[model samples]
Target: MEFRAKTVAESRVETVHIIRPTDLNDAGRLFGGVLMQWIDEVAALVAKRHSQMNVTTASVDNLRFLQGAFQRDVIVIIGRVTHVGNTSMEVKVETYVEHTNGKRDLINRAFLTEIGLGDDNRPAILPRLILETEEDRKEWERAEMRRNLRAKQRKEGFHFYGE
Candidate 1:
């Protein structure tokens, strides 16, 4: 049986600010950690919608800082679940800077895999994923690759910074 799949944009919960003061480095740039925090929050929301259970970050893959966000600029975090696994969902989040003139630029892109936890504090199964569009197909393929990579790394006994 096939279950319905939800898009990343559909599960976005909120848009937080990329305040100038958050740039602790004083390099006149928004900090990388700040952007990650925003992405985590948004990805959590997407995971909750898909799993209907408490979720926690399993791993963050391919978080590339493509551009920088200015102090007063607004970073819009858009996120959605691209694939649902037996006990985890992969969420793709894109952050963009909105200029005063209404121009938008893609600042960063990342993928997060979060596992749904049951009341027993163990991973739980989620609804099956359904791919609807070409973009979704591409994302699903990418997600599969990421999953395989993570598994291989785990078997090799490597410790990552964040999981």
Candidate 2:
């Protein structure tokens, strides 16, 4: 079977949401879980767009919370495919908060791995990612490194379930 390569631009997705009082914590800041949910949703969209197949979240890495967002602030989430394997893709997600004064501050960044699934729910081959710009190339390289590290960890019997 043959699959057409897709550009990173083709899989890019951006979403914006306004923080509400209910979305905030006792300290009046946006909750980390809410941001993580948005990140996963956006990243899944990017993976599905890139592969044109059903995708499932395999893991999330380096989910850094850099800043706090207050209620009524606009939260912007951007997701783009950074790398692709035969059956998986890596997406980088960045979240920013726009204040009332129109200043945007980055609040969080993360990388998510998604595995493509066929109709039978088995691993499905994914289309290759075409890096169009220098930034895309750099991101691809970084994603490759992370993938390798993950594989090595798996080989070393690294388990997340705390068995």
RMSD of each: 3.0, 1.9
Q: How close is candidate 1 to the true structure, as a TM-score?
A: 0.85
**Best-matching candidate per lDDT:** 2
Q: Please, what are the lDDT tens digits per residue for candidate 1 over residues 1-163? A: 2335555455556575756784645687888887898899999988888777789998888899997777678878888788777888889898888888978899899999899888888988777666767987988888889888888997898768754
Q: Largest TM-score belongs to which candidate?
A: 2
TM-score to true structure, per model? 0.85, 0.93
Clashing pairs in 2: none
Task: Please write out the lDDT profile of model 2 over residues 6-52, one tens digit for every residue.
Answer: 99999899999999988998889998888889999999999988888
Model 2, global lDDT: 0.91
Please identify model 1 stretches exceeding 4 Å from their true place: 1-18, 156-163
Q: After superposition, how far is residue 6 of candidate 1 from its true place, in Å?
A: 4.7
* Count of clashing pairs, candidate 2: 0
